[model samples]
Target chain A: MTVGRKLWAIIIIKIFIIFAILRLFFFPDFLNSKSDTDEGKGDYVREQLINRN
Target chain B: MIDQIDLSMVDWARAQFALTAIYHWLFVPLTLGLSFLVAIMETIYVKTGNPEWKKITKFWMILFGINFAIGVATGIILEFQFGTNWSNYSWFVGDIFGAPLAIEGIMAFFLESTFIAIMFFGWNKVSKGFHLTASWLTAIGASLSALWILVANAWMQSPTGMEFNPDTARNEMVDFWEILFSPMAFNKFLHTISNGYVIGSIFVIGISSWFLLKKRHILMAKRSILVAAIFGLITSIFLVGTGDGSAYTVAQSQPMKLAAMEGLYEGEAGAGLVAFGILNPDKKPGDGEDAFLVKVQIPSLLSILGYRNTEAYVPGVEDIVNGGYKPWFEKIPVEEKEMTYSVAQKIEKGKLAISALRDYKTATRAGDSILAKISQKKLQENFNYFGYGYLNNPESVIPNIPLTFYSFHIMVFLGFYFILLFIVMLFFVNRTTLEKKRWLLWISLWTIPLAYIASQAGWVVAEVGRQPWVIQDLLPTVAAVSMIDTNSIRITFWIFAGLFTALLIAEVMIMVRQIKIGPKEGGSK
Candidate 1:
């Protein structure tokens, strides 16, 4: 375990974590469909209340 | 009309926050304190040319590694919760809240993770100086993480560096520095870090003492206790000071929170602080049935802490609840004419009811006693309604008071106990042999769980006391939720529960493996 090797190991870990985080943020659709359904439901509830009023 | 639905949402969100926050805290204190311990051990090795110091560092690092893994796992869920349970709040305040979180991930997480890996696996690879530098950087990274998280949370409590936007219905940050240096942020960051230092120091001292008592690693144990004691003393004192500052800030900015924390009911000059109390709001404080166990009264303590004067007015629960003090809304002025008309109608209705009852009594005097009794019952019910404001029984608005009360007490009691424990350890280390005191060693071992309990109680108090409010007075918790169906929440909750549980178990397994291995055998030389 040389200094250069250690540095490389750390760098690789960081790259992986960062990449995962970015992918999760960008392609959030693949991870979960609940977010979209959540948004739709919120809008539906608000619209229903408005219509009743 | 929407209150019931809103209340349920608030409760659910609060429960989720409580679970995550408690679990997150279980690891965070150790991270903060353990980082410092590792840095100190490495420093001692570098200075004293002792392989034993290296061994001490390695052992604690193993525990630190376990804590870090769980901390990271729990922390991820917390961030997701902001979106899942509190989606509206995220949308409303993300502009302000998201900044610190982003900085924490970018600046602190990278530094921490990078250095941590090097420190863990780079023993034979890096230069001595480079290795030591990695350890120190990791320590700094942990502190920086605390700083950023506290900044975000403190901003929520006190609201700094932000202005209200009518269009977005949210607060937007105006200045980064303002948010960073806000009084709330400063106090909370210091207080939290200090607690971390205390926890970390106590843990090292406890484990080292255990080894010493067993006659294994006596020399290393002695050094570890000495280092821990020094840190323990400094952090103990710092914790007290920072706690005072935090309380003072809460009194100024979040008076309702301060009142709830103290359980004050009536306004008074130099009010007595409740050390222990069976808080029954249905009865007065000294009613003998539901009274506080008054242990000690430091006169003018609250006033001095809050206002820098002994006579400053601290508003009580009654004032806040019944004084018509709306937090974020303007008071509407009543029209005198409309008010008079309403009052006259109420009075007229009452007079007509009284006359009808009197007539029924007179008419039934010589005939039916049963009819008269029925009329009297109706009259009494109507009168009681006017007097009590409603005939219908309102649903209970009370919080789970007993749980809140004891959780609060447990936290406070631990705070004081830890203060004394640290003090005693410091004294023994400075004067007598800390190793000889078997009783103190055992106590230190037990303080490990005490730290976790205190951390949990703090979370319980914050989330539980806030109750219906997700954003403290501005937004109700239920209104802040994502409009997803109950089934959706249930599904995600289970998924998260499974994932977190697996991560927790994995973390524990790794920690046990490291501890079994003990310190690394080879020396750098």
Candidate 2:
């Protein structure tokens, strides 16, 4: 392959590694995982906010 | 509602975010400006029907691709961090902040991504005109992406067009147009993009200067320098104007930041601009010690810059924290003043606002609409100082003054230097004496890193200057972090630090290899 295609290949692989593997494993959304429903998430955030001194 | 919070977690989370942001920035400005510079080169190539121009365009495009790819890798992590490390910040201001980010993803990112493919791969397959259009569109799309993100950032710096909703426990967007067209947003977008343009020009000229020093691609180096120097000169001048606009906005909206940027302890009418200074390490807001150890200042410049009047009052850190100084009118030339609350008074108002919000929430839960309305009204009245409620002391409001002051001065100093460098470069190139000026060539080559330093320093001034506020006046950063364990953030920070450093090394290696290969071997056309 040409050098251009090689660079493109690296980019695609990097994205897949970062988003699909690393993000899913290491960086799950905190609020989303805190509760199953929107109301629960809202309650979680509200509790965190109000309880801060 | 929750257990005793770990203060260490908050500090670690901040460190993680700062790490990601600073690293992300290293690559982003290059992509912002280089895309446009490459497009400009391509336009010249097509118009002139010159193969040499095509070679130059293709060569630069390769480097742009390298920087753009790595930049995206770092950028995506920053967004994810909001959900991971700063979930509370995300949830609190999600309704308002998410709009710009979502639009950035849906519109600008998509536009740039689509055109970038054509820009890279459709060279021989597409007509020259179509390819050129794609190139231009890619550049435009990158800038549009910057626009939305910077607008969101500006809103954080100067929160507007949002209302705190007690029922939802979040700040919600009330006026989309107001958020989009805020004066802070406008200046931020212009300043940031001009900064990008300047970085791009510097990068181009810097690399071209290397070629001239080596006595290879002599013609190409001269042509590239000519274009880049002209572009750099114009954008550098524009960057100065935007910087001034930024200072004025900061003075009007974030006086604490302005005070910190100057390290001013005791404010006065017609405060001079600090041309250079060393901060007194022992100085505190109310302390009688000198704020600066040694200093040189341009008389009345700070007043003129901040308030557009020679004699307009500029507040010091002490004045802002202890409060007796009147707030100048937002309109330039400062015709009138209004009474301003001290930090202590604002904290009281903030507590009232917070209490009212709680009451409003409770009333809503109890289905008492009348009580809820009254509580909401009270909350609204004091909501302007809501973030201050979380602070235990007025001293917590002071950001790291030394960092902000130094970063601002460094950025300003480098900005003027860039204009001078460009003028000298243009003159030498025109006279065909640039290659002979070995010292100048070395200076030009070294400027690539200085451009990066200047760009990063600008962000340091902006982000570090407005410390303790994730969303200006509304939210404290300590309250913004997710309630996750500190160890997790610490681990991730190390992981990211190691990973990003590796990526940066690989990028530099690849870029160096490409630069060595030279334009003849770039082989696009």
Candidate 3:
């Protein structure tokens, strides 16, 4: 590939790493997790965001 | 459903989405109109072989490139957010909303993305006719993508041709044509694209006027002004017509939103439009205090605009809460058809829907077919106002009226102001006459930021007016959010804010530098 194409590829890869890959590893899918019951999960968010204040 | 949504999570997710949308908008309007403008210029150049038209087209093309890049960057995050921040909403309407987005990718995005490459890279490689076709196709592609997305959004506001699939626990499309050609969606697409057209016209006029002011590129700037003025004027007229259609739709599908937008607290037989008014801050629903502080109203205009006739009843906040609109739905046969349903009635129905769902869940697990059947029947019957079940208080249905009321007025005022601006520009602008009128040129230059403000304000009116609803009466905004920790969203929100801000600064610096360079040197950069 040409140098221009190579540079564009690297730029795109860096963006993908920052947005997609890093997010998947660092930000767990709290919503989809099976550890908590539906009510327990709902209550957790409600308490943390709204009723606490 | 008994519990109110996690307010903090919803608020944070909304904030993040708003940030992304606002940033994305900054680039989209320019891309929408400027692409077509550039194409028109190129068309002129090819037909006449005018070097001047080629230079003008190249100059704007550079700016469009700068704007389109940032728009795409911000746009990807917004799409990702549908899966992350609003997972519940995604699941609920995925069967319906996903179609348009998919079609947008297959039809609009491919058309735009393929041709845009040809437009930029195939300048000398392809024949002039082929290149011109690519340019027009790119613009059409961008517009078609917007059409599908707006259709999806409009479905949320006025959901039509869709049915609740109780077995699947989501809405399913019964008719694709109905979804695509809903009157509300059609009007929305027309109105929104016209808005983009106006923005593009202003951008061309503003930048060209700036060049004129500097006594540089006077001839090219004049031609640009002439084109944008004629185009802008025509679109501005259409913008007003579609605005009327939007108001009419709000009256029919989301009356509560219209009531909030007008700051009307009590139903009236002949309601007048608020020509201009300050909302009385102390006044709220159930309070007897007058809603507006200082006001000017056009008698019966709202009634005419809302309904075709002046005598048609317009429900207000009090009417909504006290059961005015319930009577309209009573003609349809239902198990719970009463003379009228107060706030209490709606809440009971909403609670019934929620309870029925819970029973169905329990029955399914226990393998109790009879119980599941009974509960599913109840759930389907009262599912119209399912979002209402989450409200702790009946009064929670009222949107933030002060914000909606003012936003709607500000948008309207600016819209009419733009028409006036367009008329003045069109009348005064000539080959050389516009060059001399420094004051008019100054107005054209300053009108740029106001055009942006008006566009943003129009969205505010639309979104804020809907209030509690994420999908009209079907889903509340709070319940639609993913059950994520507020802190997680907050941290990312700030990160994106900083990142997008930096990109914006870079974009502006590059744009300003290119504009300063003029056509000859700027095109290469």
Best by TM-score: 2
lDDT of 1 by residue, B201-257 (tens): 888887777776776777777778888878887887888888788877877666656
Q: What is candidate 2's TM-score against the reference? A: 0.97
Compose the digit string of candidate 2's lDDT tens values, residues B6-122: 778888888888898888888888998899989999999999998989988988998999888767867788888899989888888867778998899999999999999999889
When 1 and 3 are scored with lDDT, the better candidate is 3
Candidate 1 segments exceeding 4 Å error: A1-53, B1-9, B281-295, B324-405, B430-433, B494-502, B505-513, B523-525
TM-score of chain A of 3: 0.43
Error of 2 at B458 (Å): 0.7
Model 3 error, position B345 (Å): 1.6
Q: Which one wins by DockQ: 2 or 3?
A: 2
Model 1 lDDT tens row, A1-53: 53234334544543444246422542132114433554453343333221211
Model 2, residue B53: C-alpha shift (Å)? 0.8
Question: In every candidate, what fraction of the native interface contacts is reproduced?
Answer: 0.00, 0.56, 0.00
Give interface RMSD, every candidate, in order: 13.6, 2.4, 7.2
lDDT of 2 at B192: 97
Worst 10 residues of 2 chain B by lDDT: B329-338
Share of the reference A-B contacts seen in candidate 3? 0.00
